[model samples]
Target: MIAYVGDFGLARFLSDVPQTSLVGVKGSTGYIALEYAMGAKASTQGDVYSYGILLLEMIPGKGPTDDMFKDNLSLRHFAKLSLPKRVMDIVDPVLLEEAKVSQGSGNHTNTRKRMHACLISMVRIGVLCSANSPRDRMEMKDVVTEMHAIKDLYLGVRIHQDEQVMSQLSGEDPSYLSYY
Candidate 1:
């Protein structure tokens, strides 16, 4: 549901077709595939790779930067090298809020535990989708499934907690907690 609009001038139209294609030997640079930069024909797979990058940007609130790929460092390389730890560092603080509320009561112990678990799952999915080898990356359908599951679980937990708070506010007996 997210869109990244880079310079359309960077996109070129083929003489024989109406469809536009990315220009320059390097395409858009930060999120482009190696095949695109190498002059191989761009495919949906290339777009999927860029979509993966876009997904990362949505979660982190920062698009890929030239610095991410500098010093022989590609985003994929950095993510893979760091895996769960450093990858979590780049996650947006918004997710931390969601994770905390998802855990209920906002207790530090519960929030930290839930956030850690959610973050780990998120990093795993992101890493899979952003694999350096396009063939190794997941299909869009699989990505959709995984993302849905994460959202469902996170929201489901939060909703249950909300119901509890509502019941308490209404002065309903706490014993009713078992029903929800």
Candidate 2:
């Protein structure tokens, strides 16, 4: 099922057509950008900020409005703090479990390292996209490119690993496996 994480009132009232600007700042509290709060008209940059927050939330499974985001701490801050250091600590338990299951009993270290690297890259994109200054934020096109690259990086490793496993089971050379 698809779930939305924005202003319910706007979603309920507004037409399905794309909107460039709204009458006023009307977004979910935590998802709204600082410029919007300061009376800046809604813009694509603002939307990018919100999308960044979504990415950050998705990986860690923590909403910006969660109780832990009090007293100057925010979803952005939480994610930024984790960085390349404590990514596993902030990542969702479900993702970790899924990784473990998919990894099976072979080459745990390599699978885990790849996972960590991908997680770091994802978090960095989110952080860049949600920068306080609109100019500093990553463009939507760039975000898309980065996301696809990360996906390819992870899946490329998985496909190679799967081919190796299949070859071992069938007593065939891994190099002779057909990628097509």
Off by over 4 Å in 2: 1-3, 7-23, 103-105, 157-180
Runs in model 1 deviating more than 4 A are 1-27, 66-68, 94-108, 157-180
**Per-prediction backbone clash count:** 0, 0
Best by the lDDT measure: 2
The C-alpha RMSD in Å for every predicted model, in order, reads 11.0, 9.9
Q: For model 2, how big is the CA root-mean-square deviation?
A: 9.9
The digit string of per-residue lDDT tens for model 2 on 1-180 reads 122567423333444445555454577767877775555555677778888888898888888898999999999989988865687789989878987887678777666766776787788778877889888888889889868866765565456554444333222442311210
Alpha carbon lDDT of each predicted model? 0.54, 0.70
